[model samples]
Target chain A: MDETIEGSFQIIGGNFANAGEASMQLKSKLVELGIDEAIIRRAAIATFEAEMNVIIYAAAGRLQYYITPHEVTIKIDDMGPGIENIELAMQEGYSTAPDWVREMGWGAGMGLPNMKKNSDEFKIDSVVGEGTTVKMIIHFS
Target chain B: MKLSSIVESISLEVKTGKNNLQNDVTGVYISDLLSDVMANSKEGNIWITLQTHLNIVAVAGLKNLSGIIIVGNRQIQQDVLQKAESEKITVMSTPLPAFEVAGKLYQLLNG
Candidate 1:
């Protein structure tokens, strides 16, 4: 592997009906590119978590995948009411998602932790009223 | 039993994929939560869900699931059905609720 590729996905906020479209497409593309299964699963899980966060909390966002011979990087940028407490949000089973989202079986607050666990590197930036952006990287061998 | 047999045995009314039964379902998993299913489901299981959303199909695709069966008499969205068809993943709907659908699938798979 001595090459690289990049893909970008636009995540629409409040689009419960159409979410995950981009992530799925990216997974297919990676499969076509012969990306490793572990790396592809990590990328898929990260994208899924990010997409859900954008849909559940943010107004809108964009996701980008940077693939290289050594590793893959994912970035999610969103515009919405940002996290007031980043540390708390990172804790598992802690969620601020409303009743409806919970009723449908999300908001377990596993999104961030799962993203971090599945990725080789993880970083999150947020402000009270600004927004949230998650950057994650997973190395390939 | 074939996937078509599971459908016939359970009396699952497929809103789509009537001809795509050539796809085999080795197992089945039932869940309404998109996130949980994506995380836990083994590949090639027919995912049964009542919460019909476009993400259901995506999760199935990610997990390489045989197909998704929407239960509880819900109407499969046009866009979702189209996506499923395009992806060659079988999509179907059942009037049965989640638990009932699960039981039926179990009986069919065992039968």
Candidate 2:
């Protein structure tokens, strides 16, 4: 186990071309830091889904990564139209994305569920008309 | 199965990452949705999709996929090809739709 390792990244809304960049970067960092490959894949998948949520739904956001010897934690806060129904939003195959977003091979209503599935710990909070934030944690052991 | 053999069997056009033809293919994953692939795809699987975008390359690289085969003869963007080459993610295509291509690949891999 090592000391705490931390980093942050910015995400721009509607930026489909660069949507996965942050997750890729974080995954590379985890690889460089020599974390377990399985754990890193989970974290990377969770982060990518969260990042895509920001791009498709939010106007902008920040993704923060915190790593300790025992676990890896990811925090994402976005400025967008917050979810009105968290339960409905959590359902698989439920999506509000416009047709255009769907055309890009995303907005399948799988993003949030996939994120939750990949995280050892997951929590989300949102305020209608304000914004949304997601936190995901993965154990290193 | 190696990517080259799959391409040869399927008669796919190699779009990029030609140098990576020797990458091993453990199985196949057929999907157009990005998150589903991210969550369910196994490493070394060959991805079959109609999506032609740069993010697919990123996803394939992230998942350590053996290669990507775009179906339906979709016109893949140039930037997507460049990204695949740089990442060494083998990319190929076929005029056949997803089902036919997937069937042929499966037969080649299993038969």
Candidate 3:
């Protein structure tokens, strides 16, 4: 509670079999830290969405989390084709995922929106032909 | 209602986490889409879906859902069941589609 808890998880892109593993681990860690139930749920949801994005689009990525007494911060950095239009990608029901991804009940274009909704602070940056980075912070009051 | 009651009432096949059948089911949310469930489902709600992938278990665990009902009698892979068992998330299967499963759950929980 007094000291900051920090950890990082490796994410393998295009690996549907293990897509949500990172988020699951993060959730377990948060639970172990005795964070509020509501806050842990929000943090887990946000982290899961971010993890899915990395797997569905990027080649690989790393998810890092820092939990302090004040806030929980999640950072995801991936290597793959970056979002060409952040605004368009942010729109609800707008997605560029392929047909195969759609059939799996994913690519709903709701990932980013869900992350933002669950986090008190959300930021995303991307470079075309490069990769993307997403940062989300949830405050504990 | 307890998950065991629903499982027996509807003849749902317990795939894994049989020990967790006593979990309380607060509500029902039917969606094949993972994000939709994550965004809307409440804790202790039993998720009804046709999805039988590994990520489904993760979603159920992350949301603290009471259990998952795989509708349409979809064939769930071994790894998914293994993960569900490890996470202690009860997963059941039904021959009926999502619509029928949802209807029956609604009646059981409300009627």
Q: For each candidate, what TM-score against the reference?
A: 0.56, 0.58, 0.58
Retained true contacts (fraction), each candidate: 0.11, 0.11, 0.11
Model 3 bad stretches (over 4 Å) = B1-111
Tens-place lDDT digits, model 2, residues B10-107: 79999888888888889999998777889999999999997765678999999999999988866666767888888988899898999998777777
Docking class for model 2 is incorrect
Count: clashes, candidate 2: 0
User: For candidate 1, lDDT tens digit of each residue in B14-90?
Assistant: 66556778777879888777767878899778888775556667788899987788776665557778887777777
**Candidate 3 global TM-score:** 0.58
lDDT of 1: 0.80
Judged by TM-score relative to the true structure, which candidate is superior, 1 or 3? Answer: 3
DockQ of 2: 0.07
Each candidate's number of clashing pairs is 0, 0, 0
Query: Model 3 chain B, poorest ten-residue lDDT window?
Result: B71-80
* Residue A124 alpha-carbon offset, candidate 1, angstroms: 0.5
Q: Report per-candidate DockQ.
A: 0.06, 0.07, 0.07
Model 3 lDDT at residue A93: 54
Candidate 3 C-alpha lDDT tens digits along A1-141? 789889898889888898778788888988887889999999999999999999999999999999888898999999989999999788655677775796687875678988999999999999999899999999987
Task: Candidate 1: list runs displaced more than 4 Å.
Answer: A1-3, B1-111
> What DockQ would you assign to candidate 3?
0.07
